[model samples]
Target chain A: MPLGDETIVLSRRQAEIGFAILAGLAGFVILFGAMEHDTGWSRSGPEAGYFPFRLGMLLMAASGVILLRVLLQRGPSEPFLSWGAAKKLLAFLLPLIGFVLLIGPVGLYLAGAAYLFVAIGLIGRVPWLKSGLIAVLVPVFLFIAFEYAFKAPLPKGPLGPLFGLI
Target chain B: MVENFTQLMQGFAVSLSAYHIALMMAGVMFGLVVGVMPGLGAPNGVSLLLPLTFTMEPVSAVILLTSMYWGALIGGSTTSILFNIPGEPSSIATTFDGYPMAKRGEATKALTFAFLSSGFGALFGVVVVTLLASSITKFALLFSPVEYFLVFVLAFASFIAFGAGSPLKTIVSILIGLALASVGMDTISGSMRLTYDIPELIRGISFLVVVIGLFGLGELLETMQNPYAAKAVTTRLDWAEVFRSAMIWPRHYASLLRSAIIGCWMGIAPGGPTAASFMSYGIGKRMSRNGANFGKGEPDGLVSAETADQAAGSAAMLPMLALGLPSSATAAVLLGGLLIWGITPGPTLFREKPEFVWGLISSMYLANVVAVIMALATVPLFARMMQVPFSITGPIIAMICVIGAWTVAGAPFDLWLLMVFGVVGFVMKALDYPLAPLVLGMVLGDRMEDAFRQSMLLSGGKFSAFLGSPLAVVISSLIALCILVAVMGAVRRRA
Candidate 1:
């Protein structure tokens, strides 16, 4: 018998099962590490590895329950991960990478402005002129507030001499 | 009695200083601004501004910073009332009734009630911290590593009970957090454990960075990911109407007192403000003439929430100052600040640093008055702060987050770690894992381990060491009960 026209959903249960397996593997790694570090019982007290060993057991136990549940579940088919969300996340990530790369070479002030201008433009789509004004003005203001007024040192670059004028 | 009086009087000596008072006022104003802003929070604000206090006298510096703490507490309600968005976690309950009232044009009434109730709650908490400081510290010192481990266990278990999704995911997230926490130094061996050959990872990760990435960057990413989005909600106020309505009815003093009690009590508990505010709001609804209007933006609802929220913020301080154990994130920052100042809080703090202790208390009273005036005056203006476009504001926040992270150790390595944690934070958020436990674990994990090792040594490795005294026995039993309850609750909820 044909079922009603319902969209097929991805097996959310399967992904959960996958996670359980991964967790079990990680648990073993942790267990191995603790055992290697001398976690055996002693006459007077628990040894150096006692707590971590217990935590590893707890992890394994929880993961076992999760894995069992995941295997027992009957579910529909659907995508486990969403591609659409990843794209949006990447937009921010790219600019963050750029900021990191530029910070040392261009200096904190200029690099900060560049990051701000680009990030704000990408996220808000504000006009370039407005974004530029904000990008340049905000960091400079911070420079004056933190570096000049408070005497807290910031990263110096080629423009370090220029900032000294403040 | 005379000693107590002299100590308090000496505290006033610092608190009553014109300079100290002025600094407190400034802190309150700054806290207000940060609290009302959607993305900014008390910890971020404190960390950002803490550097400025270096040159100020310690008393004045504390006065200012703590006032900012109070200011942020009150300022959070402003946005929660005007917009449904809570500026701080403590104000989440305020949005339930406060926003509904604002939507109906009772913005002024809501704001006014929120302001006054917060003032009352804070003053009440001040009295409690003042009187109960000694006893609380005495109680805290009795907590051994095993007891603290149990407390941490109970706290971590809560994620399974309170978090919205599958317990498996929450545990995974917690493990990840614990793993991350372990990346720095091996306490016993005095060796770098998981630095991955990076000199920066040797210091571990920064809490500020982790939180900012998790809360700020993750949120921004989530908002951008939403395909269908309307323009950000912005509101304009009719100042005259707001003021008129705000003054229409006298406040319920009894309700304020009740909420204050609720705040102080809940602040001491594990749930903190979220529970305190809800409990106060519930009580207000049950005991009000406007009971039927609870969710429709009644002014009384606003007052109930405001009183309890601020009171919780202040009461949360008791554990931090009295016990040297921070009950919440903001309290953690204050604790860290105290450590940096070479001041060890807890039972001995009263005897060793009476000036610091009393000075903090006296400043609270002054900060309350300062914050109230500042909030009332600034509410209308701060409401318009969103006018600053995201391009400008967003980057500024990120910059602050970066700077704040770097300042923790003054290392660029921490900055890199911050970026990584930010990404991890984003993923954890998407997976419905709570970040608080991870943070609590990171903060307390080493201490818990150290205490366990020390107790073992003391007992000559006897397991019975944990159950030696009646106090230890009772605390240990309670911890066992907590775990059993937590596990049972999870199973029931799943069923």
Candidate 2:
């Protein structure tokens, strides 16, 4: 997408537009869905849909006010997302994607260690040995602390029982 | 009250255990480290450790978490004073003057004052927790679901007033957060809202994941964007320079006492550290002719702001522990931890588990002393941590975020949800929405629904029951007033 103007600091109108659409969608979804489920203030004391229906009304009301505010606003233009900023954001985000993809295939400890090492090295650029040591040690410690010591069951992958080796 | 004292003495006996004292010390140390690290606030630290609390007895868990909170609050001030970086939202105001003072070659003095003040402030909060816990819980427990929801709504409305320039965007960001909160299973019915055929969304989103993304990952991204920002370098670290003995007792008596009172008041009111610190600092500044030198390495200014923040941070626990009312986001997360531990907060806790309550309170005394010593002793080390390039911490925080998200549900789908929330958080940040309220709303949303249902059911579905109780009426009115202020601010802006 081509970049918008960069000089503006606040973009109220754009925000309102986005919120309005979201609110309308949320309202419609809840209203129709709840009505279908027979949401009413009848015998079962305010039916299943009663609270949700009210919530939908709130969503619509808040969004409507937001939409009106945005439409009325006028000021310096804003670049919603700049390429430089996006790239910087992506630097952190892409690794996040990798970490997520790695989570299930590898258990939390191993995956967490890998994620930690890669992230630390990527940001700090410490000596490889130091970074590696930290990465391996942190997750191991956490696993021992939470999983073993605290008895909180963290995810264990195919190497599940093998994790006991650590 | 006398009985409360006897119970407190009993609590001291339980807290005096070497193992429990050691845990408090460890919690303080860990909390300080987490707080010193940019982007990981008290709430994130407490929530991340929530799983660990499972193995602990309730008293130990509460001690660990509360002490950790104390540590984190104090820890945040270290970054603000040393590196011009506030570790959390509460510390933001601290940097306005704190950094300026550090640059003027009084880093040691500034740090010392902060440490002392924070300790004093926390002690103040503890006193309130001990004295007023029963009464406070009774008052807060009377609030109905409608009142509680409106409190969320009203607290959210304050953002519009505060974020006046982009009120529309702020409201939008809040709605986005609310909508995101709605994605998981419906609290009233077992039905899902926006799961969209994914089982991961069935559990909804983890508040920790979103916080990690916002504070840790978002900070990493932000730091990278401003990579060329001026670096902080300090050369001097003399023991005598850091601690002035002659002024110690006099400064201590005045600064500590004033900051503690300010912290307790601010903590009870839910104004948070930002307000508490600034208020204390302002009072300190006004009291002394140090006004001109306040931000320029004035030892007292640093002490007042830093101390008040810690005090308020500790005092904030009063509401959470006693009333089940969280005065800040960190307390809210602690609330989550309390719920997870199967311990219901509020007045019943005292009657049901006095030992647990007393032990936790006694642990506070140990944690505060330990935290002050550890924080001051490790000053140089933490300062060096600031030198760790953003490039490395950036990726590492990202990794932690993933682990944290996955840990929340052990599902791959949550990883995606984490990203979605991260984007939403970033957008919210850009649009000027306060993320805390969103987290609070989501955390409390399910409970609010239940409270509403229960209250109605009890009253035979009489709508007026929400306001029938005097306590409920008072709270509901306050909530209404807050919303009125927010709506009025929005309307005036439009006009």
Best by lDDT: 1
Worst 10 residues of 1 chain B by lDDT: B225-234
lDDT of 1 by residue, B1-495 (tens): 455567677888878988887788888988987787655778667766765565666666677778988998899888787767677777887888888877776777777778878888898988888777767767777766655554555555654554444666667666755655555666776555445466667776656566666655655555455432212233554568656755654457767777889889867655556667888899889997887888887777777888888888788777777656565566766766676567765677877788888998877877898898788888757777745544456557777777776555577666676677677665556555565556555555666666677777667777796788777777667666655766777679779
Compose the digit string of candidate 2's lDDT tens values, residues A6-88.
43333445654774776567766755545544466655456556666666666677667766756776776555655565666
Off by over 4 Å in 1: A1-36, A40-84, B1-6, B50-62, B141-179, B226-251, B286-289
Per-candidate interface DockQ score: 0.37, 0.40
True contacts kept of each: 0.39, 0.42
Clashes of each: 8, 12
* Tens digit per residue, CA lDDT, model 2, B188-293: 6676655555666677776666765665555555566566332564634557865683257355567667777887887776666767877888898888556677
Among incorrect, acceptable, medium and high, the docking class of model 1 is: acceptable
Per-residue lDDT of A100 in model 1: 70
> What value does DockQ give for candidate 1?
0.37
Compose the digit string of candidate 1's lDDT tens values, residues A1-166. 4333232232355556665777677666666556645576566355656656666676787788878876776766454345555555676778876887777777777888888888886565888888888888988888887786777777867888876775
- TM for candidate 1 is 0.87
